[model samples]
Structure formats: C-alpha cells, structure tokens
Target: MSRRRVQTLPRASDDTVIPDPEQRHLLWARGYLYAREPSEPPHPWWRSHELGGRTLHFDPRLELSVARHGETFVAVLGIAVDLSEWLTGLGDIAEMLLDHRLRSRSAMIRALDRVCGRYIVIDGRGEHAWIQGDASCSRPVYYSTTADAYASHAHLLAAVTGSPRHPRFPDPNGLGKRTYAMPGNCTPWRDVRVLTPNTDLCLTTGEISRFFPRSRIEHRDPLLIIDHLGPLLERQLELLTREHRLLISLTAGLDSRTTLALSRSVADRVEYFCYEFPEVREGRSPEKQQDSEISRQLAERVGVTFHTVPMPYRYPEEPLLSVTRANATLFSHPALGLSHLTSGLDDRLHIRSSHFEVARRWFRRHGATQIPVDGKEMARLLTEYHGNEAPFVEEFDRFYALTDFESTEDLCDQHDLFYWEHRAGTWVPHFLAESDVAYENYTIVNARHIYEWLMSAPHRLRSNAAVQRGLITRYWPEAMEFPINGQMKEHFPAQVACAPDRASSRNWSMSGLAASLKQFLRGNSASRHFR
Candidate 1:
C-alpha cells in the first residue's frame, strides 16, 4: 500500500492545531481518535466509524482495521504483527483474535500486547470500552476527562475540550542544552493525562491502572532468552521488509549493532543510512562522526547500500514550533526540526534503535546496590540521572501517589520498570510523535515478549551487554568484527571475558554461568568500568 501525507486537511492557528497541521487533521502525522457519542467526525476530513458506543476517527494515511465476533469487537490502527502467527499482519491478527474467547477487556489488552508492532488497540463489549497502545507506547494515547475523549496527542484533547494549560508548564516554547520531559503521566494540560505503557484506560469510567507485571519476573537462562530473541527479531524484520521498503538507521552503538545483526538475513533488501549533521560533518561532533563513519564502513563491508544524509539543524517555523510545544513536552530534540530532511522519504519505513536501554540498567546509580525506597527517592534519582533544572520531584511524587507499584514490588526491578514505562515509554514515543511529520518509524525491540525475555535474564548478563552480544552472534557474528562506540570488543576485557560464547551458549547452565560471572567480577580490574 502506498502512503502519502494528506495536506488538504483544514487548519486554523498553531495553538489550535494538534500535531503537524501540514499532514492531516489527525493527532500526529498519522494518528487515531476515539470519541464517545460524537455527532460528526472529530474533523471534517477524518473518516469516522462507529464502534458500539464510541466513534473511531482517523486519517486515510493511517491503517485502520476492525473485526467483530458475536458481541465483542477489535479495531487496530497502525501496523502490528501477531506473535502466534509471525507472518500474519494486523488485519489478520484482529480477525484471528476475534475467534478466541477473550473473556474481558483486560484479557483482550494483554493479548494485543503480545502482538508485536506499533499501534493502538480499541476493544469493548457493548457500551463499555478500553484503549491502549503498543508496548513501549510507540503510538501514544492521551485522554482529556473534560472532553471525555481519547486521542494520539495530548494537544488534540486540549484543543477539543478548550482546556487551559497547566500553570506548572506555562512555557512550552523553552529550549536549552538539556530539557526534561513532562514527569510521570502528567501532561501540559490540566484536564489531559498521558497513558503510560503497560497500563490500560477504561473509556466508560475514565480509570487508568497497570495491567502488566501480573506476576514476578523469573530469572531465566541468558542463552534461552537469546535463542528466543534471535528468531523473533529476524522474523519481524523479514516480515517488515516484505511489506515495506526499510531505511534502518546505523550507528556505532551496541543497540544499533544489535539491530544491524538482526537484519543480516535481509541486508540485501534493506537500505541503511546514518544521519550526518553539520556538527559531525564539520568535525565538531566526534561521536556523531564515529556513528556515521562506522555505519558506512560496516555497510560497505557487508555489501549493502548505505547513504550519509545531511541533517543540518534548522530552527522550525514559529507556527510548527507552537503546535509541537502543545503536542510534546521535550521540544529541544533535533528530530523535531529535522523533519524537513526526512519528509521526502515517505515511502520508506525508518527503523531505529529504541526500547533496548531497559536491559542496560540505564537508570542504575554507580556504586549504589540498593533500590530507591519510594517515589521520592526515585524522583531524586531522576533529578540526578537526567540533570533536570526544573522541579520534577513534586510531579514525580504526585505520580507515585497515583500509581500502584506496591502490587508489582517484587515482580521486577522498579528502576527497570521506570525506564521502560517512564523513560522509553514517555520520552521515545513523544520524540517519535514529533518526528512523525517526517517519516513513519518502527523498532524491532518494541515487542513485550522480547522485553520479558530481556528483563528475565540474569542481572549480570543484562547489565553488561552480554545478552545483546550473544543475540548478535547468534544471527551475524561477523557484524561484531567492527568496533562498537569506538571501542573494539577485545579492548573491553570485561565484555570479552564475560560475554557468553555463542557456540556453547546453549550448553552452559545458568547457575554455572552466574558463579563464573561472580568470580570474574571479583578478580577483574576492569569490573569497576562495567555497569
């Protein structure tokens, strides 16, 4: 199917617009809408369909599919892959799921999370309903209680409800070297709130609560998890390549390398590119230079086509910036202004590295072994970790008060969940929404099943990048021959010593590996450098 932006949509002012006014009347570049008892379409240009008590509105640029069975119905907007049927697409998955006896909205949401892809699922029986987005919330869902509606962008709800901006976030136009995303599930509007990942929203009651981590995370063998992830990533990539031309972002980081390794089987079919900004091109950014250079060298070695695209930082127009401030909290990201560079590649799906940091202990404090006792401590950690100049402690405290983490205290590390739900879920998706004006994006690591495997692996393996290294070796060991982040694998004695040997990964027992790792950590001088 051909995808193109619909620029014919009506527009008023920047404050009145939702996402990208140039795209469509939808929330973002391609967004969905859920309004209860709407007299007409949310916008004159959007196509509206009634689903029981609610009306679903979306632009023709978006993918919308619905399936009904008996009194229950399932509608999915955006792309999704059925895990049970790896080759099946979202439309088939929706119809296939209707055959199953999903007893409640909770059960339906759980099943939808298992389906790997970026999208939002809307399901309900009769007048009662629920809404949730993909794992890691690649497609975000925001709700306004005053408007009694659900949408892709928070600004859309605010504009519809005429909700005044929250006093705390008065200046959305502020930009600096470092800026903070709106803490927790709070939004810029007093009446609107963002839906955190792994949480479900009830349309009828307007209640939000966690539905994941239903049970404690069990420690699993790293090799088993690696084995499971290797095939899943490859199949997902293969499925994507067959349907759409892919432009996978390449870099000198382990995350992007892991993505590259997974795409080895489909390398010939995929196009690779690295963003070459003016800073890197002018030798001002050594790190970005390494990213572009290494990616180019690796692609040349693998005999795949690669391009170094110029990504000059151009300030967005006042009108675009105003609408962006309304839709997203972190407006300082370069992607917000670089849409002009990527908008021409509308036919290719941009794949990038996101949602992989949860396994890397991203939020862990150095030399601190104990977990933070409560939300206040967590807020303090965020302040220090993210270096926020704004007062996030109060927002975090409020968020902690509303969330029920006590129910999941023992399930997994609270810090990891924070990264998954708060960091990646909130930050990454908002950036994606902002960049949606350019080209659609996807990440293979967006699957909840992959996250489960990553989260359940032994801590030592998960934190040290051994799990990722092992997965890469499983698919394409040759890809690792290149240096990662300017450091060769052999130079990092800790990684070389602790990395699971791919040949015998399956033969080693978890307890045996854990014992060896403990001994290695105690004796190795480089252990201090490892996180």
Candidate 2:
C-alpha cells in the first residue's frame, strides 16, 4: 500500500542533553514510511484497505527526533499485517511475528520479529532489519545511511537526501546495470547486503538472524509440494486477476501453455495473444509448418480468445538499442530480443515460453553420467565449423566456463551423491537457476518450475521425467505415439534431410563479425544491440 520506515535514535538523559547532535553521531536508525493514494494500494497494504484490516495511525503531534547514545542507538519496530481470517493459512502476519520471535533472540531481533511482510529496519542504536513474505515480494526496500536520512524506495531515498535522480548516484555503475528485482526479496544499498529469504538482520550487535532455513522443503513429496505450489500460484493469480481483464502470451511451448491453461482454469475471462514473425513462417520446413498449425489448432480448440500480433523481422537499428536497454537489467541478449518483442503489449499476464533443456543439456554433457568428453574435444566440436578462428573458439570456452554448471558440478560432487548415481539429483538447483534467470528476463514471469519440481521429487513420489510425460500426454496425446516403434521417418525427419553445408568465406566472415560485435557490446549495451 504505502512505503514505511522505522528510524531509531538514542534515548537522551532527563534535562541536560544536547538537542542537535551531528547527523553522524546517531548509532542505529530505521523506520518505515510509505506514500499511496487513499485508493489503489500495493500488496500487503491492500489487504488492510477495509475497516477490518490494519490502518496507518499517523501522529501529527509526534515530532521527528533523533537521539544518540555512546556509539549505538536502539529502535523498536512494530509492523502490522492486515488479513482476513480466510487467508490465515497463507502465513498470517501474527504467525510470522511469532515465528520471527522464535528464530531471533536478541532485543533488536525481537523488534524486527514483530514486523511482517516486506520490511527494512535500521536502528540508530546499532540494528538493521529486512524481511519479505511467502507468495509475493512486491514491496521494495532500499537504504543509504551515507545521507542524512536512510529511506526505503530508491527514488524516495534520493528525494529525501536532495541527491540527483540517478538510480546509481551512490554506486553508479553497479546498481544501474542490475535492474530486475526478483519477486519477494530485497537488495539493500552497496554497504547493506541482503538478509536472504526467511531471514532477518540485527545490526545492533552486528548479528544477522534466520527466521527460517533454506532446507524447510527438503522432505516434501511431490504431491505435498504441489499442494503448496497450487495455493501459492492461486494467490498470485488472484492478486493479478483483480482488474478482471488479463492478457497471456501463448505458444506451442510448454511454459506458456501451462500458464494459459492455469489462467483459463481460474480467471472468469481471458484474452490470449501470440507473436508470429513472418520470417520464421516463410522459411519454415514441413515440420515447422506442422508445429505452427498444431499451435493454432490447439488455441482454437481450447476456446481462448486469441489474437496474433505480427512483428516484422526487420526494424530500424536505433530502436533496437532502446528496446534492449529497457530490459538490460533482467535479460541477456537472446532473452532481450524476446522481451523487446513483447514490450508492445498491455496484457497483465504476460506469459513467456522458456524451457530448461539448455541447462539440462549442459549438465548432462558435463556430468559423470555421460560418456567422458574432454572440454578440448567439445571445444573442437563447437569450433570446427567456424574455421580456425582462435578468438571465436576462445570466446566459446569463456561462455561455457562462466555458466552456473561449473559451480553446480562441484556442489553435485559434495552434496548430491545420490543424484549423481541415480542421474536425477541436479533438478532443484538446476531449476532454481533456470527459473530465477527467466524471471529476471521477463516482465510478468511464469514458468514450469512447479511441474519440474514434481518431476524431480523423490522416486516414490514422482520423477521429473514423469511430470513431463504426463503433461505431454494430458495436452497433446495425439503426438505421443508418433515416435513409437523407432519411427525415424516421423521423429528424426529433420536429421535425415539435413546435410552439413561446407563453411564458405562469407560464412566465416559473418561468424567473425557476430563474435566481434557480441564482444564489443559486452555488458547491457551488447545485449541490447544484438537483441
């Protein structure tokens, strides 16, 4: 609803106290301040809009004061959450407060333990706090004690400090480049780090607290996990569905398909949209045509109100930069192109089609289960077609080395021995990385993580492969039997018709230029230029 801040100052002695202490003298300070129209409010605040919900009690007579102690100041925060009785199962605010108390032991911890939803607290008495809720994390809290007042939303923080309107004034290069905010989290200013999900912070004694640990869902079975997910997703839809009308970017792909199907199940009405580039259609082989036809037929059969948005393959080069720059914070080049394509729509539920196959292939290739292929050999395979371009080969190696799989491999060795043996264990971390990256890339994000989780849960529950098969069977049963009996004609037709074209001089030239252009545009600008 509104941004809130809690500022803490030292408690002065009875009579002989200096009223104007230097701004630097204060030890701990934090508070919540928010601005919202009396009408449309943001979430957890929206929950309290009615008379039954919590309302802000503004005290005009209360003078804004700062107190100072030796080196530390203490401030207590009282945060209130407004929820109807029906929504209590979704972690009521009071329950969160109680849980915070149990998890945090110190006085500063006790103060933060009371505040629920998304929050950031800094006590002049030597304490700091940050927290978020379970389903949605929309509230943004940022701080900078470098200025006289440490404020929550970035713009407000700037306004209060009389600083420039730049989002990067404090840390010009770093924060400017990182734009997408993951739902349900906080990224404090440069000096103040995140407290992590289900965690709290108490700067007083320089101690951070954990209200909940990462392993809370460790023993959950597929059905139980889905039960949790169904409600969480339902809550998200309910919140987004408020304006009645909704738009979905649908495709033949699984991610968007699942989102469209789910939205159809819940929303009273819906409008489905898709982007069809003529170039893709014009060059389409028989199989590609078949896929496109199937997608059209499926959308029609589902009775969704469908609209096709046609975007030409070519555009002026300058606008490309503007489009890509808009999304630089969230996506890399490949993803930035897609985001630019969807930027024209006003749909509330902007669905994206993403798959984990790329990450899966990377892991499967590198993991022990696969036949051992030396990095040099893979590098050769990747570069042989591009002539003897040392630079291109070097860049390819760097890209592969930078991926999360390199680190995940180490983690797999240490903690996922069972998965390593069973050939199924990299699912959680793999899916998390994939989902987080996708969310960062798109504006309104949705994915198949729920299904992926179901598929990867313990064998006694359901394998991740099973979920994939089930979805395929449930929606497109007709295509299920096509590859039966080793039918190469139907399933491997593309591979059969294809002959590797020898690389021409022009091909080599384009490859070099693409590589160089890519390198030149490194960072956000590069992604925007190409995308």
Candidate 3:
C-alpha cells in the first residue's frame, strides 16, 4: 500500500494525461459500487467483464456479480436468481417480471417484483441503491463518506484519508448490543452504516429510503392463501429444480417438511441430506440421529434419496480454523459449530428454511406469556446487548417510535421487521461463508416475497403456524405421518406449535460488554484471507 501513479491503458507519449492514482480500496463484502464524483474517468485498477446483459468492473472478490440494462445497473454479491439471460433485455423491474416467459414471474411480481436473492441493486441512472435482501439482511452492505468520496469500503477509506479507527475517529452510527449482530444502517465504526434488508439509499446525498411491503399488499381470505400459495411454491420448486442439482437440507422440523412437500413434484431430481451429531447431554439420545431417520422417512415416502453426513459437535483443533471462523463471522456472534458439516463438501447449491419462524406470530407474547411491547420493552429487546446500557437507554425512544409509527402493521410485524432488517439480514451472509468450503452458494427458500405475504395477511392466519401446518397437510399429509421435533407417538401436525424459546440472555455488565467490544474491534485485523 503506497502512493504511486495509476497504471492506465498503454499511455500516449503525452505522460501528462496519466493522472496520479487518486485512491483505491475495496469493501469487505465481496462486491461493491464505488462512487467517484459520478463523472470521473473509470479507474485504472478496475478490470471489466460481461455476464448476462451487464458489465462488471471488479477483481479480487467472490460472490460479487453485476449487470446493466440501459442506464439501470444490477449488482449482486450473494445468492440471487440467474437473470443474466433474462436481464439482457432489462427494462422496468415490474415489466420484466411480468413477462409470460419469465420463470416464476408471478411469484416475482407479488414478491416486490424482485428476483429472489440476497442482493443489492444499483440503479446508476437513478443515482440510488436498492437493497433487496428481504427483511432478514442475510446479505449485508455498508457505505461511508471520507475525504471527498462516498464509499462502501469503510476501513480502506479511513486508511486512505488518514482517519483513526477509534478514539479520534469512532463509530458515529454504531449499533447497540442487541442489534449488533443484525445491525441495520449502523456499524461499530464511525461514519460507516449498514444497509438492512428491504431498504434503499441514495448515492449522491446519502439520503436513505425504504420499501415497506407489508403496508402495500392486500390480505385475501386465509383459505385463499393456500390456494394462492400452491402456484407460488410451485414456481419456486420449478426454478430450483431446473437450474440446481437440488440439495435439500432436511430436519425433523416443520420448516424443512414444508419445503419437502413443495419439492415433491421434482422428487426424482431431489436429494435430501441431514447431519447426525453426537448427543450433547448425559443419557440423552442422539437427537440428530433420530432426526436423520425422520428426514429419511420423509424422503422415502416422497420417493427421493436421502444422505446422512455424520458430524462431530466439536471440530478438531486447527489454528487456522479459528482465525478463518472469526473472520468469516467477523467475530459478531459465537461460532455455531458447523465446521464439521461444511468442511468436507464440494461446491453445490444448498437450500434450507430460515426466516420461516418470524413469518408467523411465533415471537409475539400470548395471553399470560406475553412479552411487553412498550417503549422500554422495545429498547431493551433491541439495544440491551450494547455493552454499555447508556446507548440503549439513549436510543430506545427512537427504536420504539419507529416500530410504533407503522399504524397498519400488526405487533408481529414489528417483531418481523426487527429480525428481518437487522438480525437475519446481517447474520446470514456470515452463516453462508462459514460453509463456503462446502457450497459455491446457498439461499433460504423462505426469503423475500414470502416474508411480505406473511406480513400482509392477518397474524391470526399465520399464528400457531396455521398457514405452515395447513400448507404441509395440503401438500404431503403423510410426511406428518410420523412424530417430529421430539413430539413422539402422534401423527398430528408433527411440528405443531410450541412455546417460544427463552428471550436473549441478559445484556453483559458494562465492563464485560466493553471487553466484548474490544474483542470485536480487533477481530478482522488478525485473520488472513481464507475464502
């Protein structure tokens, strides 16, 4: 890293035309859109290539891809629909989605008229950025202003501009503890902001805008939901089966079974897999072993293949593994202990059910067991973990008022927004990287339109997982023929409703939280590039 002249194309003998290398840095998230006065000649460091109908000017990243349609630009860093051929003729997102030839076009239109993917779209012509990662920002993006340029590569911007990482220069928009792992438009570092799922931002003025799909859609009758969902699910299955050598991550859970039910049409092409792990508690049976059998049975009944990969709860000692684990997750959360599962696989598309829990009233308080929904409760629920309680106390009103202002959305919608925007949205990209050793890419089936549709309908329809259970029965009643989720000896909706798990553990004492903060601050600096 040194100041040097930029190496441009074979320069004319007139060396005066070769401007000095102004600045160069990359965002940590695989791909990025770097704005340089919006009119500067293209940088010398950029390399260009064409995919689908658009062009990408980048090197040095994985999972980042971009394309262009007229003046609108589409860039994706994580999992997204392959619109390369379809988008070559990109026009209005709505019209493109409405095409009779577009696969799953109906579902796409209903789902915000967006291609299902954890991605960010930059409309160069519009001078704005759209983050379409659904409510859970399983994919994440960040941007900051340093010196004279607005940038997504925060650390590099800080470095190039001679700004301190802390002290003199600290987090201006830092996330509170509870919302840290899933922060939206907030980061621990000063001047950097996160792009939560389902939100967007302007490139020039740095003004933020958002699309609230819940307030826009109409709620048809609940029974009609089932009728409507069949085709949407069918479209998803069709898309998955046609392009992917489908690998379904199975478990003895309603989420996966619901997925299994839909995959039945393409059962011949599908393969099911689950992990078999050792028991964690004394005298406890191996839950994963039993779960493996349940998944095997479901696949057998559906007439597809099943494979159980034996996994150890603890991965063996390897120094490099720890460093990579920290960087992959950015030390935001504790390791999930899935190294054993992801370490030995080849790159293949994998699918699982995430974000399904929040779609229903799963997080809402019931009659006597309800959690409070007041300002204090909202602040504590969101910012409690921020190490020091001061930030949480200071920011609670803003958090509470934001959720409270959406008049038409139900309380459960508040719950979903918190998870979708901050928790799931920010967390999943890291989750995928931990398993990058196994798959080239992966996606959650219950992403995007599904979340919007769930939030649009009355909570009662989805409460008790009525829609989920009803959908399962409608599609594959026999899969529920066996006990699931430790609900033994009954054929009733196997993954029936259960009480919510305990709320998050108490926030750390100030000193302890501070220590954790210091640890995270030092995290990325130690790890070498592993992916």
Candidate 4:
C-alpha cells in the first residue's frame, strides 16, 4: 500500500523509466507525458494506460477514456458512479460518439452537459492540446514546467524536474510549502499554469492559449433561482442515495438541518450524527444548555436514528502533520474536535454548510447591500461594547494586514482573465480557493457533482443575494435579529472575555497569536474551547 508501489505502472517503452526517490511515475505516449504519485492506496476498480497515442493514468479511483475522432483525439476523466441509471447515461454519451451521430466537439459538450460530476477533457491534434471541465472545479489539477517539458501534479512534477534545486530557488521545502498553501486546485509550476474552470486552454506550437474565459450565471429572481436549485438538489440526493447507508452531520445550524430534512424526505432509515463537547455539558451557562437542547430537539423531530459523539479535550499527537498532510487550512476548534469525534465513520455522508460564508460574501458583492438599520446599529454598538479589548483588536488587525484584500478585479489579473469576454473568471479564483480546501482530504461522491451543476446554473446578482438572505432569515434568525458585532458582548454579555486556551500541548503559538489578534482588531472577544 506504499505510495511508491501503487504509483508503479508498466512502461510503454521497453526501457525502465527510473523514478526519482521522491517522484512517482511519469509515463509518456503520444505527444504528452502524464505523471502522478500514489498519495493514497490504489482503488481496486481504477484503471490506467499509456496507449492510443496518449498517456492516460490516474491514481486511487478514477474513470477515463482516450479516443480519436477524425483527425483529433480526446481524453476524458470522469467520476465513477455506483448507480446503474447514471452509468447508462454515460454509456449513451460514449455510444453517441461511436455511432458518429455526434461530432467530437458536439460530443464533448453533450458529455459535459449530462455529467453531474468532476471531469476533465484533453483534446488536441498534432502538438496542439486543449483542456476543459464543468464549472464546479471540484478536483485538484496542478501543472509545472521545466527546461525540457511541462508537468502537472504538485509532488510528482517538483520531484521529476529537479527545479527545486535550481540556483534561483534551491530549497524544495520552501517551494513545496508555498505550493501547498496556494488556494486553487491547479498550480502550473512557473511556466505551467492552472486552467480556470468553465474555461478551455489550447496549446499550439509550444504556446498555450485560452479559448474560453470564465462564465457567470445571469441574474434572475429569487423564486426562479430556488426553483432551479430544487431540481438539482433532488437529483443529487437521488444519486447519493445509491449508497448502502446515508449518514448526515447534523447541527443546530440551518445548512445541515435543511440538508438532513431534505434527505429524510427522500431516503429511508437515514442515520444522523451530532458532536457535543464535554465543556458545553459541564458549563455553568444557561445559553450553552439551550444551544445543546436545540440540536437534540431537532434530531428528535427528524425522527431518525441519531448518534452523539463527545469531543475529546485534547487532540491526538502531531495534529499539525495530520492537518497539513490532509491539505487543510482554517482549522476551527469545533471542526478539529469533530474530526476526531467522527473519525470512526468510514462511509458517512457529511452534509455541512461550510460554503455558507462564501455564499454570503458572493451575495453581498452582487446585491443585497441594504444592511438593516438594526443590523448596522447593532454592529456599531457591539464595536463600542468590546472597544476596551485592545489585545484582541491589535491581533485581528495584524492578521487582516497579511491577507490579500484586492478587489475581484485584481484577483482576476492574477489569472490573466481581467479582460476576458465572460465574467466567469471573476468567480474562478474564488471557486478554486474554496474547492481546493474542500477536496483536500474528502472523497465526495454525489455532493461534488451537485455543486458542479449549481456552479453552472444561471442566477442574477439579486437572486444570489436573495438565496443567501433567505437562508439566513430561515435558519439563523437570532443572529440576524440581534446582529451583535463584538464577540465579547455577544458571548460574555457583561463579563470580561478570558484569554484563549493556550495550555494545550497541540497549540500552535503562531495560530494562537493570530486568533487573539483577530478578536482584538475586530473588536470581538471570544475563545474556542479546543484551542
């Protein structure tokens, strides 16, 4: 099960291709070379080959096709669905191409239109090539360039090119760390670059050209937007239900609660899971008890089997290594604790509202700029309430300074899409940042597909804003009604806020400093129990 053995594949050529100690396999055929390391165990169902004038290989579990059409050739990597109906849909697409009823371009578009999962297509003739995918950008696809050729896959490309040892940047560790922290699923090394989702890249005469720019959904009414979402969600739930058992991570929060309710409406005997911290149970606070009670009540109302997992006070040894290896950032105390609590579930479906924050930001940017007087006054009041928390204010300001706060236009510049015809590029950077984090460790089966479909659907700025505003109103009415800004006043009310938990052996000093500073600068004071 070691990465090395799993990455080894029979070479197309007679001579053995020696892999670098750190590098995995780099197989070449046709006009391109495909390389990757076995980061995880090889799935028994996956397949790969260096044939048909092309090198197509994928690790773990993946489904792909490399076929020719007239003078052009196409390579497609698709999600392996478990349902027979879904498989039939895929077979139909393939059959269309074989029957000559759909041309290569038409077939590619048709396939994408029907595919509700993560996919990539590499099409080309001679030395020219192009790549395209659906809007979600769920999968991580990176590439790099060396003196000789361009490569993709962070670990494999870096090891093979020895670019890490170049005089300009002789430290591979530093380069690796930088690449690791990048937000997108794609990071073309130096000369190589990631292709934006909803985009197409063409390579001709050793030069890469962008054929399609990022596209955005047109604005529409809130009800219409929800009408569209309703079908996508229903279809996605139906697809996901193919699993033997469905497990949902339910919280008092609206996102998961809505998902759980919807799933229950469709699936039979769904299992629900909740996590409770010991500190909350032993707390001498009525508010904490009420919060816990609300979650318990919801689970009872759902009328499904429920399991409560108690969070441990301390994290396991080497928490950083575990998190870093998993390619995760932004480790909230509760989420980190839940990671341990839910470690036992092997085939569980984790329906969460982690994307709500991004959705809110998107809504604010598009429309919904009217912050109610109460909300605005509440923000100002809370700002004054915690004004005395200087330490927290100072810390937050420091961290905010380190962040890249450039307008969306500036971010578009980074991807060379500032002037692109479509506004799709505007959201690509954002999607890449969020999707990169979400796909870091999880193997999302149907949820990812649903996300892709949502990304492609048309929506007006107002509609997007409405979906967010409606969600907040429906789920977190208390937060909207109170609109407290300062955490000190919000959590501690009249009492002074206490220092964060810094006694844990797993505490990262830098992280603790950042957290403390965030509270100070934002005029909010609160402590996470797991910190």
User: Per-residue error at 92 for model 1, in Å?
Assistant: 1.8
Q: All candidates' TM-scores?
A: 0.84, 0.41, 0.65, 0.52
Error of 4 at 448 (Å): 12
The TM-score-based order of candidates, best leading, equals: 1, 3, 4, 2
Best by lDDT: 1
* Residue 311 error, candidate 2, Å: 4.3
> Residue-wise lDDT of candidate 1 within 1-531, one digit each (tens)?
422111122211223334444534323456666777465555555667778587777755567777776557777777777776673555677765554525665556566656887788777667777788888888888888676688888777777777788877654345232334566677778888888888877888877778788888787766567767787777888888887889888888899888987887788899887777778867898888888888888888767878776665645555655656555656645444355345455467788788888877776634223464356555555555444344566777666655665566788878888778877877677777766655577888787777887888666656777678777665556677889998876311223333344444334456665565455556543242232
User: Which stretches of candidate 4 lie above 4 Å from their native place?
Assistant: 1-33, 36-47, 51-54, 65-75, 78-107, 110-114, 124-128, 147-153, 165-193, 203-217, 252-254, 274-296, 308-342, 348-465, 468-531
Best-performing candidate as measured by TM-score: 1
Model 3: lDDT of residue 506 = 15
- lDDT agreement with native, every candidate: 0.68, 0.31, 0.46, 0.36
Candidate 3 structure lDDT? 0.46
| lDDT (Cα, 0-100) at 191 in candidate 2 | 30
Mind giving the per-residue lDDT tens digits that candidate 2 earns over 173-202? Answer: 242322212111112233322222223333
Residue 466 C-alpha lDDT in model 4: 36
Each prediction's RMSD to truth: 6.4, 18.4, 15.4, 15.9
Candidate 4 Cα deviation (angstroms), residue 386: 21
| Order of models, best lDDT first | 1, 3, 4, 2
Please give the range of 10 consecutive residues that has the lowest summed lDDT in model 2: 45-54
